[model samples]
Structure formats: C-alpha cells, structure tokens
Target chain A: MMYSPAIIAEAVVNGLMTGAVYALIALGLTLVYGVLHIINFAHGALLTAAMFAVWAVYVAFGLDPYLAILPLTPLFFGLGYAVQRFVIGPASHGSDSNILLVTLGLSIAIENALLAGFRSDTRTLNTDYGFQVVELGPLLLSKPRLIGFGAAVLVTVLLWLLLSRTDTGKAIRAVAKEKLGASLVGIDVAHVYAVTFGLGCACLAVAACLLMPTFYVNPRIGQAFVLVAFTIVVLGGMGSIPGALVGGLFIGVVESLCGLFLGDSLGQIGIFLIFILVLLVRPTGLFGAKA
Target chain B: MLEVRSLRAGYGGTEVLRGLDLSVGAGEIVAVLGSNGVGKTTLNKVLSGVLRANEGEIRFDGKTLTGASSADIVEAGLIHVPEGRKIFPNMSVRENLELGSYRRGRERRSANLERVFETFPRLRERSGQAAGTLSGGEQQMLAIGRGMMAEPRLLILDEPSLGLSPLLVEEMFTLIRRLNGEGLPILLVEQNVVQSLECASRAYILENGLFALSGTAEQVRNDPELKRAYLGM
Candidate 1:
C-alpha cells in the first residue's frame, strides 16, 4: 500500500484520541493496585457494567452520556466501596494466589451476569455528534473521540492534584506505600483501601460515559480492552498514574500505525509483541522499580 | 498510663511474647530492653494492634484497648513509632508528619506540625525532602517527630537507636529524656541496654518473651546478674 504524510498524520491523531480512553481505563486499574496490591482482574468487567448503566439511563430518560457522569461517578464509587468492604476486605490478608483467584472468579461472574442480563447483543449509543468529524487543515478528527480525549486529560490532572495536594489523597498514598506504617501514623488503612477502590471505580464511571458516544459495548467488549489496559498498566509501572497515561498513548499510536502497515488482525499482535518485549527487557516496566 | 498484662502473642504457631506483663506510669519513661528474638518488637506490635494478643489485657489511659484497631489505639493516644524508622519513605518529611494526625489531632494539624519542627530543627530544614533520603539518625528523629505530631499521651518507641552511631545514640537518648521531661509518658523499646537504662526511669530486661529483671534504672544497672548478662560487665 502507498502511504502519504496526510495519512500518517491522521493515523497519529486517531491513535492519540483512542489512547486517551485507554489511559482513563487503565488509571482505575493502577489506582486500585497501588493501594490494595491487587490486580483487580474484574476492573474491565466493572467498566462494562458502568457502560450498561449509562446505556440504560440513556434509553430510559434520553439523557446525554456526558450528563450521566454526575450520578454514575458516585454510584460506581459506592459500588466499589461496598465490594471492597464486603467482598475483598476479608480476604485481603490471604496469600496472593488466593486474592488472584478471587478477582478472576469475580471477573467471570461479572461477565456472565452481563451476558445473562443484556444478552449477547452489541449496543451503541446514538448521539447527534457520534458520527460528526471536525476538520483541521488536511486532517479530520471525530467529535466524540476529541471529547473523550479532553475528558481523559482533564480527569488525569484532577486526579494528580487530588493525590498530591489533598489530605485524603495523601492518606491514600501513605497506605499505598506502607500499610503497617500508615497505621502507626493513625491512618485507617482498611478505610483507605475502600476509598481507593471507590476512586478506581469512579474512574470507570467516567471512562464508560466518555466512551459511549465513540464505541459499541457488549459483554465481551471489556475482554478486548482489558488485555490492552493490563499492558498499559505494566508498561507504565504497576501503580504509576503518569505512566498509565504515557503508556496508553504509546500503545494507541503503535496499534494505529500497525493497523495501517500490517492490517487489522496484526494490530493486536503488535501490541502483544511490545508487551512481551517490555516484560523481557524491563520486567518492572518503564517506570517500575525492582520490587 | 499504659498497662499490658499476661500478654501472649506469636507469629502463626511459634509464641514470642509469653505472658509478658508491663506497665508505665504517666510522665515516666519506661524501657523494655531485650536481645534479638526475645520478642520486644512483638510486644510493641501487640500494644499497637499490628498483631493480636492471644491472651492479654491492654489499658491505655484507663481505656480497654486490648483488641482495638490501630486507628483506635492511636486515637487513644497510644502512638507507636515502629522499629527501623518506619516513615513513609516516598513522602516528604512534612507529609509524613501530617499523616501522624490522620485519625486524631487533625484539627490542630498545622500547629502540631510547627511544634514537631521545633522539636527537630534539622527535620524542619528538610521538611520538603523524602523521608527515605534522610540518614538513619534523622529517620529515627523524623519517626519520633511524626509520632509527636499526633499529640500522643503515651508514645512507644521501638528500637529508636538500633542502627545509630555512638554519638547519635547519645543524642537520641538525650532527646528522649527531654521529651519525657515535658511530662509525656514514653515506652522505649530497645536492645541498647546501657543508654536505655540511663534514659529510662524504670527498665525491664526481657528474655524468652518474659522479663528476667525489672526495677528502677539505678537498681537494675547495679544488679550483678543483669549487668553481666546484658552488658558483659
């Protein structure tokens, strides 16, 4: 196939837009892992559930996905808090394998529940701007993708401020670093875990809402994205927030360029190739240290 | 102000603190000194709620704290500065001190922070530096300063001078004495028998998870058997 500068430029832009969505999704996974030290295998499943919730709201009240953010963020936060307090809290002290098994089981359960509840049909949101594209010079950008990208960057900044500047955020960071030491300083470690998990879920709520206008959702859609999210999280360092953002953008660019050069089926292979290469070269990831 | 009776605790199946009984009066600095593996750290863990006591009664300021969560124990003003200077290494000195009052004393956080800085002028200068980068002696000071920020009624220091230089060890003991002089009760756990006895009003020499000797610092320091066993006198 013949390539042009305009084609490459458009691909780069497309890559960045999709990368932002991945970053937002991966941020939730990293935050939970940072404090709880659990991979939260069911994180993508939670995203799928949030998408369905937003979808239901849209179908019932005809509310815009952006407007759905107000209620959904808190709703998922509560859901996350409950899950951590009631489900994961008791088993947290167990061995790593046990926790992994629990999360894996949870992933399967959520996926099955979505399938049972909504069937296997794919669903997409019908927004007025869903198909609209904004022309900039010789390149065109999807309106929905641009909004999603903007929201992702905005949330990232807000999260960074919260973690570095707020008391609650400092407490979360403390718990993330040293659990027993955090208690020595009078931190409620279990409560911190719940809050961190809630925050992670809240990110999923935002990601789900932002993504509705751009992508189709189904029970299995989460699986497609989860591997990519995991790749980004590992590439960025397990719990590094900035690392997730960078990794997501990088992966998006790589996938876009690969799809252009090697065709669609080979795009995922390209991602995995990079994942394995990173794992081989730097097992701790780009930002991670040898733990 | 702090009391632990017949405390029995251990890791999994192996018992460490076997029926250990200890007490500290208000405004007194009592030291629990022991060699490694004798369970001094275990006792601190039990008191701080890091490990559950198999059988014991812990009373702090007349409140039953035997099985209270760490947050509750800390809120009750039984602050434990854990062994090996367990400061939040990635956080700045100020942030580490701020976390000291996460559960209690938050209302007076800024004032308490200033007070801590006053106590350790060196820490004040390095308030923005990461705790991990501080020297061993400074880390211990930071740990204690962080504990003080909680406005602790009773402070527990575990191995505060573990790896300090001889000169720094002297400085640490003097600092502990000054803090105790301010009418704050302290339970100093250490293996540095000589300095600990010198600084503590009363001392307990633990062996096999039980105190083999206990008395006033002068009395214990003079005890022939205690001196020979711990100090190789």
Candidate 2:
C-alpha cells in the first residue's frame, strides 16, 4: 500500500475521534466494575438498547437525536437501578461468577429482544451534522465525530471530578475498595451499588445517543462493541477510571493504525492479538493494581 | 452509649455469633478479647451493621440499630474501625480521612481533619501519600484517624493492634486510652488480652459465640480462670 501524508493525518484524526467514543463506552463499564465488583456483561447491549430507544423516539415523535438523550438518560438510569436491585443484586450474593452469568443472560435477552422489536435492520440518525465535515488544515473532521469526541471528554472529566471530589464519589470509591469497611464507616453499600450502576448506564445512554450520527445501529451491533469494550476495560485495568480513558484512546489509535497499515480485518485481529499480549505481559492491565 | 443484647448472626448456614451480649458506657473503653475464629470480628460486624444479626437488639443512644444500614449507624454516631486497617488503599491519607465523615461529618470535615492530623502527626506529615504505601503501624493510625474524622459517639476498634510491632501495639493502646480519656466511648476488640485489660474499664471474653467472662478489667484480670486461659499463668 502506498502511504500518503494526507491519508496518515486522516487516519490519526479518525483514530482519536473513534477512541473518544470507545472511552465513553468503556468508562461506564469500568465505573460499574469499580463500585459494584461485578462484570456488567450487558453493558454493550444496554448501549444498543439506548441507541434503539433514541431511534424510536426520533421515528415516533420526530424528536431531534440529541434532544432524545435528555429523556433517555434518566429513563435508562432508572432501568439500570432496577436491574441492579432485582436481577444483578441477587446474583451478586454468591460467587462473582453468578453475577457474570446473570449479566451474560441479560445481554443475550436484551439483544434478542431488540432483534425482535426493532428487527435486525440497520438504523442511523438523520441529522444535519451527520454528513457534514469540517477542515482543519491537513485534517478533516466529521461534525458528529467532533461532537461525540467533545461529549466523551466532557463526560470523562465530569466523572473523574465526581469520583475524586464529592462525598458520594468518595463513598463509591470506598465501596469499590472495601465493602465491609465502607459499611463499617456507615457508607450504604447497596445504595452506592445502585447509583454506580445507574451512573454507568447513564454514561452508555449518552454514548449511544452520540454514537447515532457516527455509526449504523442494529440489534447485533452490541455484540460487535461488547468485546471491544471488555477488551478496553481489561486493558485499562479492571476498575481504574483513568486507566479506562487512556486504554480506550490507545486501543482506538492502535486499531486505526492497524487498519491503515494492515487490512481492515487484520486490524481487528491485531487488536485481539494486543489483548492477548497484554494479558500475558501485564495481566493487571496498564493501570490496574494487584487486587 | 451502646448495647448489644442476645446477638446472633451467621454466614451461609454457619452461625458465627450466637446469642452474645455486650455494652459500652459513656467515656468508657470496653475491650472485647478472644482467640482467632471466636467471633471477635463477627461481633464488630454485627454491632457496626456490616452483618445483619439473626436475632438481637442493638441500642445506640437509646435508638434501635439492629436492622439499620451502616450509613444510618454511622449517622447515628457509632463508628467502626475494622480489622486489617481497611483504609482506602489508593486514596491519599487526607482523602481517606475525609471519607470517614462522608455520611454525617461533611460539615465538620476540615476541623475533623485537623484534629486527626494533630492526633497522628505522621498522617498530617504524609497526608498526600497513598494509604497502601504506609507502614503497618502508620496504616493503623490512619484507620483510627479516619474513624476519628467521623466524630463518633461510640467508636468500635476491631483488633487495632493486629500486625503491629510490640512498640506500635503499645502506642496504639495508649492512643485508644487517650481517645477514651477525651470522653469518647469505645469498644476495643482484640486478642491482646493483657494490654486490652489494662486499657479497658470493662472487659468481655468471647468463646464459641457467647460471653465467657465479663467484669471490670481488674476483676477479670485477677480471675483465676481468665489468667490461666488467656495469660497462660
């Protein structure tokens, strides 16, 4: 393949944009893991569901795609809270594997349900910004990609502040580190778990809405992103927020580079190869502590 | 300030605390001494609302706390410093201390932080260090300092002396006595019988989920049975 300077610049720009979106996705996964100590396997499916919900609102009510997220976030937040309280909570009683199994089942059920309700047909948001592109010297950026990237960064910063500065955030971190000690200090572990799960789902809802203009959505699309998100979570360290952010961006750039230098299919294979290598070399991930 | 009556609790069909009773009065230090696996930690768990008691009544400041949540218990001013010095490992010493007052001590956070720093000058000196990196003795101080940040009415210290050097252990006991002297009621749970008895006003010995001995520390210390079993005298 002949390499062009313009193409390389475009690839790098695209990698960063896509990396932001991936970080948004992985942030929720990492947050839930950090506080709740469970792998929320259904996280990707929840994102898919949110995407479909946004599409449904757009189709039924003719609401703007961005406007749809306003109502969708709280709706999904409540749903996430309920899911943690009822389904996930019970499964969390025993071994960690129990919660894993339950969430996996939830993922399967959600994907199939979306498939039945919305069909397997692909969908995209019709927005003025969807197809628009802006030029910045040698690099060109899509409007939606720019907006999504901005939103991702904003959300990541907001979450970081919340976890580090606020009382609730500290409570959540305490629960993540030591549930027994948290309870001893009068931190409500159950409430923190519910809120953390809700927060994670809310992040997904936002990511899904932002993602609409940039990518096509379908019932099975979550299957495509789930593995990638998990890979990001694992690579970033299981429960580290900063790790997730850096890991997501790194993966995004790596994928872009692979696609540019290698074939597209080989790019994905290369990403997985990186996952395997990371597992062998730094099992705790780049930022993960030895728990 | 606190009383646990007929407390019974367990995990996975195995009962850990079976019909236990204990109490701590205002400005007093009550030590709970026991061998490992005899439910010293379990008593703390039940009293602190970390574990739900199967049958018992826990009264704190005349409030029923048996089934209350841990946050509620903390809000009620009953704080528990758990075993193994469960400080937030990744957080800075200051952040860990700040979180201690998370539920009910938010308003007095800064003042309490100052008080904790004064008490454990080492913590103040290394307030920005990650708690996990602290030495075992320093971690124990951080744990107690965090507990103090909550402005607890009745603080429960569970095996505070565990994993400490003999010198640090003495220092920890002295700190506990100092805190008690400052008019805070405390429940000190430990395996170090002699020091615990020396520091506590009253003492309880737990064995097989029940009180094996209970009296003033002096009386309990002088008892022939306790001396033989615990002191190897």
Candidate 3:
C-alpha cells in the first residue's frame, strides 16, 4: 500500500504536534530527574490527577481547559511541592531505592484513588475548539494541538530562562549538582527539592490542559503518556532540557511513522526499541553530562 | 567570633569528633590541624551543619546553632568551604561563584562576584568554563572564591590545599593569609600542620577527637608532642 505525499506530510506534522506535547510531559520528568535523580513512578498518576482537575472544573463550572491552566498550573505546582517536601523527601530519606519504592507506592495509591473517584470512564473536554482545524498549505492541523505545540515550546523557553537567569533556578542547578554545597550557601535544600518537584508538576499541569481538549483521560491515560515520557527522558539525556524537547519530537516522528507503517500497537514497540537502543549505544544519553 | 563547646559528632557507631571545645575570636586566624582519621573533616562537617553534634554546643556570633539547619547557620554568616572542592562540576565558574550568595549575599552578589574575580584573576579568565574542566589548583581557588561570595562573617576552610601541587599549596597558604589580613575571622582546617601553624594566629591540634594541644601559633608549634607526632622531631 502506497501512501501519498500529502498523507505522509500530515502524519509527520501530526507527530511533531504530538511530540511537542510529549516534550511538555517530559520537561517535568527531566527536571525532577536532573535534581532528584529519581524516576518518579508517580509522574503519570500526577498527570492523570491534573487531567482530572481540568476535567472536573470544565464539567462543574464550564471553565475552558485552556483557562484552567492558569489556576491549575500553580495548584499542581503546590501539590507537587507538598508531595516532595512532605511525602517523597521525608519518606525516602535520600536513598535511591527508597525514593523509587515510595514513588511507586504513591503511583499505585494515586491511580487507585482516581480510579475510585472518577471510575474507569474516559472524560474529555468537549470545548467549541474541539473540532476546529487550521489549514496550512496541504496539511490540516488541529487548532488545539497547534496551540499545544506553541505553548509547550514557549513554556520550555520560559523554564530555560528561569533556570539560567534567576536566583531560584541557579540554586536548583546547584542543588542538582551538589546538595550539601547548596545548603552550605544558605539555600534551603528541602525547599529547593520541593520547588524543582513543583516545577515538574507545573509542566505536567500545562501538558494536561493541552491534552484534555484533544484527548480523553481516565485513571490509566497518563500511564500511556508517561511510558513514552520516560523513553524521551532517556533518549534526550536524563537531565538536559533541550534534550527532552528534541527527544520528544524525535520520538513523536518515529512513533508516527511507525504507526503509519507498522500499525498502532507495533508503533508503541518502536518507542521502546529506540529506548533500549539509546541505552545500549549512548548510555549517557544525547545531552547527559559525560560521567 | 565563633565558639564550639565540647563538640561531639560521628557517623553511625563510631565517633569521629569526641568532646572537643574550640573557638575563633573576631579578626583571628585559627588553624585546626590534624592527620588522617583524626576528625578534621568531621569537625568541619559539624561546624557547617552538614552533620549533627552528638553532644555539644555551637554558638556562632552569640547565636546558638547547635540545632540550626544549614540555611540558618549560613544566614548567621558562618560559611564553610567544604573539603574535596565540591564545586558543581557541570556549571560554569561564574555560576558556581554566583551561587555562593544564594543565602546571605544576594544584594551584593555582583559586587562580591567582581571582588572574587579580582581576587582570583584566573577564575575571571575561565569564568565561563565548566568547573570540572579547570585544573586542580584552579578548582580549589574557585571553591575559596565561592566561599568569599557568601560574605562570611567567619569563614571555615576544609582541606583547601588537599590535592594541589606543592607550589600551589604555597600559594594557597598565602591566599589564606591574605584573606585573614582583611579582618575576617577564619577557621583553617587542614592536615598540613607546618603551614597551618605558620599561617594562623592561634592553633589547635586535634588528636583522638579532642584538642591535644592549643595555644598561640608559636606555643602549639613548639609543643613537644606536636613536634614529635606532626613534625617528627
């Protein structure tokens, strides 16, 4: 079966758009990993919770998902900070395995709680912009997805500025590199940990808002995105911001092409195959600092 | 001025610093010299709030900091340049220095940065380079420069000369002396006994987690046990 150039272009465009969203999902994971050095198993659950938050507000008050980002971003940030400060940081006690187990346990608890509250039903925002599309040359891109792409990139740029240009961001990088040194300089280490986690969650909140309009959410929806996110984090280099963004887009294109050629289920395998290959060939990741 | 009373600290079941009392008066350079395994680094840790005291009191500038957090201790202007030159390897030299004022010197960060650059002209030259890429001596200079950025009321330097070459070690001692000449009280913790006593106004020789001998530099340097154990007289 031969596909037309138009179809291929559309597929690539779709992948890029989706990849931008994936980058948003990954920004948080990369930031958390860069500082905390832990694979937050609960990241997906947090996404699901943020999606539900957006969904709940939309359903109850008719607030737009786009608008929900304003309130939800900071709310999720606070939530993430509290989780790290109160739950994860204290419970893990600075041990790697303990952090892993605690996050894993938190993931299970959150998923179950969401499963109970919202049940297994898939909820999506049926906004007026839901069916809108923009015509660009021969390709028709979904308006919401385009917004998501621009917004994700914008947020990433903003995050880069925060890290490179601000005091809090410098403190975060310092803590990421040297925790004891960061404290010796008077940065509250616990506070910086919470802030980094909060920023990670805030990224997820924005991603959740972007995804809610074009996508549906259930207790398990975030699991799917997070699996791809983990692949991107590894592919891009664990702690590199640009790596996450580009890795997300690269994986997005790869997944899209794989779906077009190998079918949907196998397309998922394409992601993991690349994940393994990257691990084997370039264990430091594309942007990871050389050990 | 900084004062520690019967400071007792250690890791797990083994005590590293056992019931040691020490102090640094204002405008004084006090050296705490010891050999390996004698709790030099451990005492620095306890004073810097990286480790807790098993039993004792730490009062910095009249504020009891026995239970204070690292940030609180720093806010009190008791800055510690830890052993091993724990500079953020991946960050730029300027960034590592900028982070020195994360707690205490925010308003004067730029000014302190300029002063650091002036003090360490080599740092200014390699300001944009990653710290890990710097030579060993340069990294030590960066570490001390970082501590200076904190506007330290009392600066504590731990093994600042550990890995430097002999010539660089001489420079390190000179820089320590110069910093002391500026009216800053310093607690110089080192294994370099001879130079430490030479550089400090007062000296405390640590042994078995206690101060075995302490007095003015001349007295401690002339002590028979110090000469026998450290100088191999």
> Which prediction has the highest lDDT against the true structure?
3
User: What DockQ does model 3 achieve?
Assistant: 0.84
Candidate achieving higher DockQ, 1 or 2: 1
Which candidate number maximizes DockQ?
3
**Where does model 3 sit among the CAPRI classes?**
high
DockQ of each: 0.79, 0.74, 0.84
Order the candidate numbers by lDDT, best to worst.
3, 1, 2
Per-residue lDDT of candidate 1, residues A143-234 (tens digit): 88988989988998999899999989999998888888998877887788899989999999999999998888999888778789999999
Tens digits of per-residue lDDT for model 2, A90-129: 7678468888999999999999999899888998877777
Q: What is the interface RMSD of each candidate, in Å?
A: 0.9, 1.1, 0.9
lDDT of 1 by residue, B1-69 (tens): 888889899999999888988899989999898889899888988899888999989998899999998
**For residues B70-149, what per-residue lDDT tens digits would candidate 3 score against the true structure?**
88888889999989888988789999999898888889999999999999999999999999899999999999999999
Candidate 1 chain A worst ten-residue window by lDDT? A91-100
User: Which pairs clash in model 3?
Assistant: none
Least accurate 10 contiguous residues by lDDT in model 3 chain B: B41-50
Q: What is the lDDT of residue B183 in candidate 2?
A: 94
